[model samples]
Target: MDNPQRNDNPWFMALYIGGAGGILATYILIGFFAARWLVGMVEGPRYWIAIGTISGLVLGSFHIVMLIKKMMGEQDG
Candidate 1:
């Protein structure tokens, strides 16, 4: 009998972790630049900081969800 939960390949795990880390790093960089740009706007830096942070979190979560879905689908196949 084959075990569904066991993944013998280490490369997949490494790639997944690397991709997730890259996504997180990208979000952080985007937030940093957005905040910097928004700081010069009339509304002030606080609003832009909040907006950037929230957007980053939302985007990161979405990426994670999509990755999980893709992984599950691949496993099922």
Candidate 2:
């Protein structure tokens, strides 16, 4: 019996990189816009900074979790 070949395409790696970049960019944009809006309502730069930092951290954590789940699923398959 022969073992099946694993997918080792460079394009897949490129796609993963591109997808991660896109997600990062999206989070950054979201953080920027959210901070800007918060700044309008709040009176200080500190609040906006805190809002942006918290939002970025939350989004980053979520992205990491999803990425881990995807990698684990691929390994199982």
Candidate 3:
């Protein structure tokens, strides 16, 4: 018997992957700009770079965690 819950369409898989990639990229870009602006007000170039990098890392991590949970069909908090 065919499993109704199983998704075998390649187009759907591609779309899902592409959407996730777009979301993560957008999130990182936003984080980078926000960090840069905030750090620019109180620090030098080095500080701005550092803060942007750190913020991007943290936000990227959180995004990955959410993506994993979502892919696993788990409920997000």
Which candidate leads the pack in TM-score? 1
lDDT tens per residue, model 3, 1-77: 54455476889778877877777777778767877777777775656666676777678768877876666565323
Stretches off by above 4 angstroms in model 3 are 1-6, 74-77
Please list the residue runs of candidate 1 whose C-alpha ends up more than 4 Å from where it truly belongs after superposition.
1-8, 74-77
Model 2 residue runs over 4 Å out of place are: 1-7, 72-77
| lDDT per residue (tens digit) for residues 1-77 in model 2 | 22255345789767876887777778877887778777778765757766796787679668966985664455543
TM-score of each: 0.66, 0.62, 0.61
> Which structure is stronger by lDDT: 2 or 3?
2
Top of the candidates by lDDT = 1
Write one digit per residue (lDDT tens) for candidate 1, span 1-77.
56577665889888887998889778867886788688866568467777887788778878887887766665544
Q: Candidate 2 or 3, higher TM-score?
A: 2
Winner of 1 and 2 under lDDT? 1
Reference-based lDDT, residue 50, model 3: 64
Residue 65, candidate 1: Cα error in Å is 1.2
